[model samples]
Target: MANLAKIVYRPVGLVGGVVAGIVAGAIFKRVWKIVDREHDAPDALQAEYSWPKMLLAATLQGAIFAAVKAAIDRGGAKGFERATGEWPGS
Candidate 1:
């Protein structure tokens, strides 16, 4: 249903995208560290302890989450149509 699709599905997609993106970004970061040089593991604050990067990730993820949440909060596709006078599907 359009209602369900817009409300539950779309927001989930948006949130999911944000989550996936953040996760990918985290993977791309050098936030982890190795406890010992001989080991390939990370140290307490060596590998992934960047405050700036963490803040950036949080902001980015929060923004994306907010965007989708706002859309769903406003109302689903029907509400969108009411305001815009345009339905996506015929």
Candidate 2:
């Protein structure tokens, strides 16, 4: 049962990961627009922005991405459990 659940969840997890990434990107873009009005968030290679601001942006983006991924993963797991009568995770 555990192996079967793992096999069934692989594709679900893949789709969930993709969807989470899209959602996180959209959210980060919107948030960056609001937080930094005239400029986009800094990438790792960019040095135009102050270190504090860049770090803050990176931290916020990471937090948002993690939260979105967790939510999507949990929802997918719950849905799988509902359909299969078995939890995907132990």
Candidate 3:
């Protein structure tokens, strides 16, 4: 049962990861637009942005990505458990 759960979870996890990334990107874009109306948040390699601004964008993006990933992973695990009658992890 656990093996089957693991097998089924692979594709579900992949799809969930892709979806989570898209959702996180959209969320971060909207948030950046709202917080910094004059310009888009700078990428790490861009030197035009100050340390504080760049750090803020990095922190916000990380938080959003983590939250979305956690949500998607948990949801996928729950669905897998429901379908297989076995938890995917020990």
- Best-performing candidate as measured by TM-score: 2
Candidate 3 stretches greater than 4 Å from native: none
- Each candidate structure's TM-score, on Cα atoms with residue i matched to residue i, is 0.34, 0.95, 0.90
Best candidate (score: lDDT): 2
Tens-digit lDDT string for candidate 3 (1-90) = 667778867888899999999999999999999999999988989999999999999999999999999999999889878877788764
CA lDDT of each candidate?
A: 0.49, 0.93, 0.91
Sorted on lDDT, best first, the list reads 2, 3, 1
Q: Please give the TM-score that candidate 1 achieves against the real structure.
A: 0.34
Model 1: per-residue lDDT, tens digit, 1-90? Answer: 555445544554555566656654454343222222332333236655466645554565566556654554445445656755654333
- Candidate 3 lDDT score at position 5: 72
Compared with the true structure, what per-residue lDDT tens digits does model 2 show for residues 1-90?
Answer: 988999989999999999999999999999999999999998877878888888989998999999999999999999999999988886
